[model samples]
Target: MDEGINSSTPAWLTEEFIEAILREDEKTQHLQVARADVQPAVAKGDNFGGLLHRVTAEIYYQNNGNNQEKSELRCIIVKSLPSDDWYREVLDQAGVFKREMRMYKVILPAMYKLLKEKLPGVTIPALTARTYTSSITNETLVLEDLRPLGYRMVDRRQQLDLEHCVVALRALAQFHALSVALNDRDPSLMDHFREGFYTPERRHILSPFLQPTLDTLASAVEKWPEYERFGDKIRQIAATSVDRIIDVVKPKNNSLCVLNHGDFWINNILFRYHPKNGKVLGAKFVDFQVSRYSSPALDLQYFIYTSAKEDVRDKSLRHLLQEYHASLTHTLQLLGCGKYAITFGELEQEMKERAFFGLITACTYLGAVLADPSEVVDLDSNFGEESRKNGGQSPMEKAYAGERFRKIFRKFLIHFENEGLL
Candidate 1:
């Protein structure tokens, strides 16, 4: 452990705070901290798409007892709001930060408790990192650092293979199933989760960024020969893009709705592999900031469009969908929510009905997904006064203009056009 902490460490992350967090995480009140070291958990470009800043705290602690306590090291990840006021205010208005805090502090614990009581003896896969503590006032969350537990994030530049996709889908299915069961137990369980990235109410907050980005994308596409038609489609979509998103995300009557991981993609998912064979064993999700109570189809579409490999995205999509459906149904049955589970036909229909979500997500996020690590833009610099000074050509816009992003986006554009979504 470092004798001195990093200068950039948050004021709230004191030795006392670390002691309290360790107590909660270890479930042992006798743990007393000797010292702690705090440093950035991820590199600048690594978590560029994430809104919150992350730091890891290493605590060297001892058990308070007469039997000769020995110091041990424990690591935890702290997620906090960005220091930039402009970015903070935008996210504050969107209510993502508080919502995520609630997700960890309230929703997940209740869901897990319910499962433990109702399905005793059933083994549930760990669907997310454990939250040791959180503070709405502090705008911070202390979570179990999954890296030390062998959970690894798939590289942003690389897409998920079949094994990884299956693991992710299984975890997502269980997550959605548990959410549905909890909602059924108490219909208002997710009242606070009603609003997410695509709500009509948040259009004002999102349009300023969405419209211009689409304009840049459309302008780029216009220069390509056969791609000019997609540029026209992009222009039309950009004119009322928010409205289109709201339409797709709005709750419909008689649909299989579950809590949507509003930003489900490769970046938000982590997988643990089998020790000997290196096969994916399980998956965990992170960043609940944009989680919304919407159709499961939204998450499915978002995952397929943003994270799947080219072969899977283009050819093996249905196979992946089948895997997700099987997992969803199996989980639903296990949780006594079998009646709420939709058939493969119904799931397919729902995904097809909301196919526009795939296009909407692709237009906005696909560039970030395909961008090289070096090409990734810092989230704050892209949004703050820097972008205005760049004449709206922020580092993000330039990333979207990159040849790799354009070429990959072109594939989706063609697919969407063929599917009549464009």
Candidate 2:
């Protein structure tokens, strides 16, 4: 369909109008009209009675007037941009949504093909079409709506059980296997495919944004003497290590590269259940805006640190690492990429280096993200206000976030000390 309607144009236009503008020869009887409507879905903020945005739609399909078939219609709960400026800023910071849509058009098709061939039982969304328009600030992806299929990510407050973790780990391993196999068979093609993923512009934007947060976080920590002991160390680490975190951890070299869902947090994954018994059947990965080529360890570390609870992390860190390594090894063997992929020891080393990357990022940003509504900055205000109000987050929340990172930092330090990997 022609998505060239002007930004000022009224959202509602007849199907004939759209069809004529697009100049499609399809019969009017077969054309479907999709309209956008806003509905309450999920709250975007943590405050009591905070405002949130979600996309809801009424879909109409043209069929014989006499025939009564339940209209194929659905409502999807999308995480909407808070404002037009926010939408524009995200596109400007990341590239335009069109660029991402094009990238997904290529990679997702390949991933779907590989999954269908190698793992027939696994279910994922079938991509129908994608469209980007001025009215839709980001981009609207039209795919088989998987929500009605009963898929959802586990809640953030809850930890996935060992069985669920195993399933997720194995699925991720298989995904990495396909990536490695593709890269091995046609190195140039894979390289070409990844060329569209990372642009220098994005790296430049991320570095500066992270640096300011690092500075603000440093200033904020000094207020608490108990935590102030680590202030200089944290600042030094943030200043000197951010580049290494981005560069070494996210190197574009072919040998170390795989397709990573850059935002690997739990919310982006959806789980479905068996219809007959209402038992969990499988999970499907979503949200490809940050999908790109990077060390697979980047995703592995992100998932573990962000999704696992403190107790789970303390008890299962080593075992979880081992399980990931073993699953990856087996999947690589199945895909015949084991010959070219890294060994478990090598993977462990990469994990150690990359694990710190996530810790630093979490310390610098997570508290601001997760603080209670009463403790957060005004969404409409400038960064100056944001920094001053909560100093980016509540003192308690920031301390908790810092403590979490301190634990991770000590773990890495001990690993390096004992193994002499430093």
Candidate 3:
């Protein structure tokens, strides 16, 4: 498929449409659009996890104000539904595209208003991208382009280090805390966000990816002498993963539930750094297509298992949890929901109760996370035409057969086996 902003670009992306949005954004009615350039934002290999087509539009407009003489350029990212019929149908059935639009339009704005009203002077860092506008009919989203603002996505193949992981955890904690506060104030705030990735209705969309990956993990583990004993356990989990994985989203304790960035991983987060010393400054999240209302543990474990380095996940996990809890408590205190804040012990209990989620992430997502650049196949190509023809193994399934994937899957299987979750 042509993944560029060329002749096939949407009809609504005309100069007149760009001019209207720009005029509203600048609050200048007289601004006139000279021209606009729209191009693909991410490179080929970087779009592995994305369900939407992404493009960046550099809008050149003449500002009618006194100080601005030349045309000022504004850059924004546009995300739209895939043009492929099969993929688009699956996303439509799952309702992820609409869920993301509502998240940016209604839910997140409410949370932002709550924060501003509750804490007038304190500046809480941003949790995600700033949405400019979105359309349910067009299946498009216009958002602030963070690239010009110095935020960049880390290489997916590289394991996230301690500093980046901490930043992500802190942001997630704030997100969870704020969602909890908003839900407490108005319970219906998340009524529309009821379905998650593992919802029964979504199985048709996910199983083609999930079942194959799990079976690949089972086949890969059976080859390892040390891990050979757990092959049956892995197969057992694969057999019932679709039905069992839903447990991750169900609220065992209703009081602790919050909104989850369901697809939280390296690809979905962007981080800003100091130019001089390369120190991490802040991070922002993106891609809420699979955002769900659930226990925060699912997001926490999904991120750590799919993104963090081995040492970080093995040794410093507790420290990371403490950091997340500290931020969560502080944010709750700021939002005047201190009484609802859970203790660290309670947070630990939450993780323990949802331990199966970590295993689910390992089987389904870890291969893509560790996939070599050469293994990056277009989602539609992999899951649509090629998938129907070649039922043997996908590039992603072959990624599971790699040694790195084997070692990581072994470790997770052992952990889950010890915990009796498998």
The 0-to-1 C-alpha lDDT of every candidate, in the order given, reads: 0.79, 0.53, 0.77
Q: Model 3, range 1-422, lDDT digits (tens) per residue?
A: 13334664666666666666667766666777555676666765565433333344334434455434555667777777875666777777778888888888888899998998898887877677888752223476778888889999998878799999999899888999899889989999788777655787777767776776677677777788877777777778777787878766787654588899888899889999999999999999988888888888889989989999988988999999999999999988888888888889999998987888888877777887777756554566666765667763465666776667677777777778888977
- Highest lDDT model number: 1
Clashing pairs in 2: 151-271, 152-271
lDDT of 1 by residue, 11-64 (tens): 666777777766766776667666666777765666542333243444444445
**lDDT score for candidate 1 against the true structure:** 0.79
**Residue pairs in steric clash, candidate 1?**
none
Model 3 alpha-carbon drift over 4 Å, by segment: 1-17, 23-30, 48-68, 134-137, 204-208, 389-392
Superposition error at 317 for model 3 (Å): 0.5
Ordered by lDDT, highest first, the candidates read 1, 3, 2
**lDDT per residue (tens digit) for residues 1-422 in model 2:** 23433342334333343433222323334545464444333333321112222333444555565433454443333332333454346444554344445445665566557657766786654422222222323344333345666666575445465556656666676666777776665555455334232344466555655666666666665555455644565577666554555565555453467766665655556677778986766666655555566788788777775666556566776777677778778877766566766777877777776767566545543453344444443444433334445645433344334444454444533443354422
Which candidate number has the best TM-score? 1
Ranking by TM-score: 1, 3, 2
TM-score of each: 0.91, 0.71, 0.89
Deviation from native of the Cα of residue 18 in model 1, angstroms: 2.5
Candidate 3: which pairs clash?
none
Cα lDDT for residue 182, model 3? 92
